[model samples]
Target chain A: MKISCVTTFLMCGNFDNTLAHNLFYVNMETPTQFISRIISNDRISEGFFELSLSWDPRAPVPMPGQFMTVRVGSLAVPLLRRPFAFAGFDADSSSAAIIYQKRGAGTELLAAARPGDELDVIGPLGTPFVIDTDQSKHVIIAGGIGLGPMLFLSSALKSRNIPARFIFGCRNKSLVPDTKMFTDADPQICTDDGSAGFRGTVADYINTNVSLDNSTTIYACGPSPMLTSVNKIAQSSGARCQVSLEAVMACGVGACMGCAVPVVGGGYARVCKEGPVFDGGEVLWERM
Target chain B: MGANVDLSVRIGNGTLANPVGVASGTFGYGGEYEGLVDFSDIGAIYTKAVTLEPRGGNAPPRLVETPSGILNSIGLANVGVEKFISDKLPYLRTLPCAVVVNVAGASEDEYRRVVERLESGCLDSVDTNGSGIFGYEVNVSCPNVHHGGLAFGTDPAQVERLTSSLRELTKRPLIIKLTPNVTDIAVVAKAAEAGGADAVSLINTLVGMVIDVKTRKPVLGAKTGGLSGPAVRPVGVALTCKARRAVSIPIIGMGGISCADDALQYILAGASAVQIGTANFVNPKTAGLVSSGIREYCIGNGISSLKEICGVAVD
Candidate 1:
């Protein structure tokens, strides 16, 4: 399936141009703090959960690959906001879903949050995936909870009837999210322990089954090592790739300069502003 | 009932509308938080460090979280003073509140050049009165740099020389930002006072580092970074108290100031005004929150003015 250029513009509305402009420029979006109520916070897998938040209808629609910074505790114990990518959004319900892994104190607090609880969130922030109309295929590769942004991107592409594929990987079967949650595309699941689908890493699956062509555009979000490998593969194959990065962020806004990611050239880019999503070639993974 | 309480503060030659202003490097040029925070309610906006030339800053992983604090090695990433004057100052001049530019450099000459540029009216065409920079918060405490920053801040002789030199260059309120990394913060504060600094602000982030046990390497690209947040608040308060006793000049206190109570604590420790630093990152509206918190504290205590409460705790 493929979406027409006209249809894409119509779907994006007047904000299409502004959104497109923000992708290349840093600190374009004026981040607003929203008191979103938790519609649901359910544990989907061990040490991982999918949280749905009902936000203001007037708030800007979150784009794929963009993230939200969630304040974990009411007090100052966990003083920083944990950045989580948008896993999905239900426009009809005026809600967005974030899939997170319990990695530290912040995520542990986030896991304890109950339904109907209000959370201080700032987002729909960072750069989103830039889908080139010329690209014939959209390949989404995700590792573990990195599936958060990929899920949203896949859902958005499916709405446009854009041809896309999902390559999901996890350490084992238990770590994998329910396949039913991903209804848009039949995911090619890979597990390191061979407890699930294809044995070995997502890179192995991509190496064996996936062939990178000129028209192929790959979008990946995962561990740094996986992203580095993906970038290498895309560069060698002459295919374009965009990767969403993760870092410890203070203000999800551009002001903090807390989440700086090294650029391929010289200088650094803020993961919260310049990108959560950056061209794979543009990132300096070796430095990170 | 709390609305009538006075939050204004005297810092150098000007009066801050409130005692709550964000510290440098935390609030990026004041325009970044336009919609999120009410500028009118803020006493002042301290812009990110501006240098003589544009600095790209350090490598990746410029910041990390430790305990209740954050370690950052941004390396003073900023547009040169020229760009700030041409592009950023116009917007800053339009704001109703006071604008304080935090200036950093590798040498005294660079600092002088930046001060001269500001004083020459090159950046103040918008504000018929003068440049938008109401004051100069000379950042002598930045740990990320090699030659000038912490070096100037830690040594009394360098602090005296830098402060006295800049004092001759501009009449703008010179607030020498002091580093707590020094052996004795009071000595450095006294040096600034003797060198004719109008006021002093302490303490900048404490130099610290975090190591990744797995990689057996430093977490920050710079190997070490300055620590700021709630974890450093006690150290800030203690240094402010010590510096207050050492210098007669007005003191601006900052360090993990998260609430109004924290601001009040600084005032009582002899700070005429307080700069909200790391708190701004955790809560963008912290300055406003701290301002209101001060008001509420005053009303609750029947304190008519901040002057009455300032240094009340000191003997």
Candidate 2:
């Protein structure tokens, strides 16, 4: 049914506000959040930087594992918006935290954000990692900044008293955030170069410690290869798994067909609409 | 007055607020541009073309950014007629300005049904100037999908059949959108008028392609797509002029109109109004710019109202 009434207000000509009714307006009405200041902007790898942000609510609160559209340059040319998953959103009594990696113009601009600068953001869009109730144990697989979305998903799951295990993967130990939020969990970390943490891929960590039949559910967000590998293990082990799919999006809302993912059933579905989150089985991963 | 000219004109049964309306498919319904483009400033917002059924659209790689344009083969993926009426239409009613819904039909009956259904609402208004609710821009020129877009637009007789069929359903004005892929756009424009169309929009996305040299394959999953953006503006202007001479009814010109200057060129070339497509991808604020630019041009030229520029050309 249509909502009793729809209300609209234009913040300005530059900023975009998404309004929808019925299935179009899903959970988390105000999802995208922006940063108030930069906490750290140190470089991690050759071109990547491990950046942290203090969240501002005027910016919508990003759902765990959701991404935002960050504008990069002062130039009007090359005006398409890029999508990035939230690294984390752990709120304290006074503030919140988010992490991202510098990749392209959007990220480069995000990296240049100073100690007192603000960024235009739209958020908590797409289906977030579902915390499954059917399983008593949970496993997380992360790769690169794909680890970003997992951080917040982990925090949300842990606060609910859900027993969780994490497998963080990156090329070197320097890439992993200083400390995984759930310190008590002693989550597993893997580095391709053995520079730190477990000296192997996160998939290897899962292979050694996880038994699919252990009342387990898997939540994963990372590089496509890592997710594909994790998906295989989760499937064979009979564990229900949800994977976050990433795409280049124009409008975070379903208006633009720029960010579409192929489904197993037939036809294309919007990553911003049907889901950035999908059952491992429901997606035709190979086709995409 | 030498370099400036007013840019508004009459379209069907209504006088537009301006002459730079948002084109179908690009704007994705009016609300998409709510805060990005001032809803009340532009002439009208022609929503994304809606079909009888909700389409899932084509697979991955639907859009590609070219030098100054974008090649998109989105396939008109929308929420079906039922969802649009029950969900999309009500929100459109709330907009502060006129809202014209672009309709895409795969068959004659579907075309009639959509027009018949829309006419039942407040869309039946006639302003003091005589044109209101504006009208329906039957999108026969969309090249993105295979179903019905270019399917009917390419054949003049079929285009005539669809136009006349819709004209019979409602007296609320009908604008048939024509494709530029044809040998002669004016032939199709005349066919549309012969079928009783009140107006027509020229030059939907031009069929084009992009390639990934590394993989040695087409960039879009569909392999080929429609090219839009500044790349197609000249083609659109030429065709809009040709169609204007062939048909007595007003013509809505479109194809890569990103700025006010681009929009004005279409007006001077004989377009009653112009539609801005690919520009929305580059700047969501484009519609507002074109609208204000027209007004600014009008005031600078001592043009009292937008009506004077309807078909004023160099000749």
Candidate 3:
């Protein structure tokens, strides 16, 4: 009788690491694809998830700033799925849209996803920007796609009746999405080219318009360079700022540790574990 | 009737449910995956290494991906012992299996401080399923961010001293995690045994590096970090074999173990148990598959238990 058991074996009669406790894990094979219906794909803002989608409710809800590795091709050239930040989820519509730029291999595939084409959604993974209410009023600052997390956070704030403002900066007005989503706070937009909204950088706009009272807190996500600039602005302004950092993440979970940001103290922190969102004061901006 | 396999294996004063377990750092305080993974299914869940004071960890650029592996300089970022006990330990008590605390001390006194706190029986409380801590792993192999982690693990006397000092604290079984960056891994393994360690885990992480050719600077915050993943499995198995021959104590093997075939190699080479570290990144389900694979191998081979095959291939 052939019998095999996943049992601990003795090595030369010596025992291995002592058993500590019983651990239970779910075998949810994160499937690479899903069946869903697209309700609407509206270009809400320069970068927004205002589009409605109805898909497998069984599909996990996308976390804020959490990404999806979507398959973009019917061919083998772009074999791997491109990762994009999940903008938001509409339970009523049952659909989600990811905001992204036309970058390399997988991202180009994302831009090609037509209506009715089923998507292979892989995630909702990665440590999300943790919003703490006790800290202060939420001030969301975005540079380009950095605006993705703010939309969802704004909806959350609106539902909670929390005071929040959206500061979005892009290369120019053409790159900035429409203003319907920002109807809440009269979003302050800045384009480097002075093509639309406020002329100059977002940090410049924050310096000109926003005042840093003791109750002010900032949440920012965009280019690392922009985050660095925001980090300095928030520091000088003396506002508690949390920035959503983007790194090349392989396994978005804490495992890969590929997405690590420098901590201000002395050691390194796993962006996926310690935080995708970290207090600006705690990060070593100069080094990054 | 085929050979009766006995999965029950005894080392020091304790017995583990199986040989497959989680390594330190990779599996945070155990509860991080509690909702997703059954803490009891694994033979042991090694908590993050706790040092004397709370660690803030290294600056960014801490992790970089290599060909098939990863290099991380996380600088052992962890909430100090106080928060660990207050926040994380309560969850450990609720686990149905044993909780192995990985201890890392900047100084000898700090190690004692951590153990002293746990000795009060607070950590051994009844779990949600009513169970207590299974054991403690002295993670001496963790690379130091201050002086570099390889210094201590490479020195035999340091290994012995670190182990012996902690051995006097509790009667609980102790396993020393060993670094593979040294010239000879067996030397340190023997030193651990001499220091009264109940067991030793081999191949913590090979000191490695990856540099982006586009930029002159190296990847990873520290420039070099511990390499782990499927790329290192062969080396891990070989080291386990060498450590097994050099010492009489039990050996916990880990490195690039991703599948059942890889784990069996470690068992055949004399590792009593194995820890799945880097693979946890590829798939959270890898551990379960490995566990299931182990059982399947035993069943198909007509082996009744895991113990029957332990070190069966040793020459």
The per-model DockQ list reads: 0.62, 0.26, 0.14
Name the regions of candidate 2 deviating beyond 4 angstroms: A1-42, A51-56, A74-77, A89-120, A132-135, A155-163, A170-187, A191-201, B1-8, B31-38, B117-134, B241-246, B309-313
DockQ of 1: 0.62
Separately for all candidates shown, the number of backbone clashes (residues 3 or more apart, or on different chains) is: 0, 11, 58
Using DockQ as the measure, which candidate wins?
1
Q: What digit string (tens of lDDT, one per residue) describes model 3 on residues B144-226?
A: 36542456678899889878887888778888889988889989999999999999987888878888788987776678778
* lDDT scores in order: 0.83, 0.71, 0.68
TM-score-better candidate, 2 vs 3: 2
Ranking by lDDT: 1, 2, 3
Taking the tens digit of each residue's C-alpha lDDT, what string does model 2 give over A1-288? 111111111111111223322213533354433434556666545455555556664544455656666555434334565666766554442234445666655577766667556655455566566556557778877787676677777766656566688877889856756543525336677899988888889888788866776378888887788888888888888888888888766666667777787778777777775678778888777776
Compute the lDDT of residue A32 as modeled in candidate 1. Answer: 71
Off by over 4 Å in 1: A1-27, B121-131
> Model 1 residue B194 lDDT?
92
Q: Each candidate's TM vs. the true structure?
A: 0.94, 0.81, 0.74
In model 1, residue pairs whose N, Cα or C atoms come closer than 3 Å (at least 3 residues apart or on different chains), thus clashing, are none
DockQ computed for model 2 against the true two-chain complex using alpha carbons: 0.26
Candidate 1 chain A, poorest ten consecutive residues by summed lDDT: A1-10
Q: Per-residue lDDT for B1-315 in model 2, tens only? A: 354554546665566656777788777766654444566666777877878788777767888767656778787888877788788877776666567778987787777787777777445454323133457889898787776789899999999999888887776657888889999988899999999988888888899989999999998888888887777888988888888788889888888787788888888888877887776655566788887787777777777665577567832
DockQ category of candidate 3: incorrect
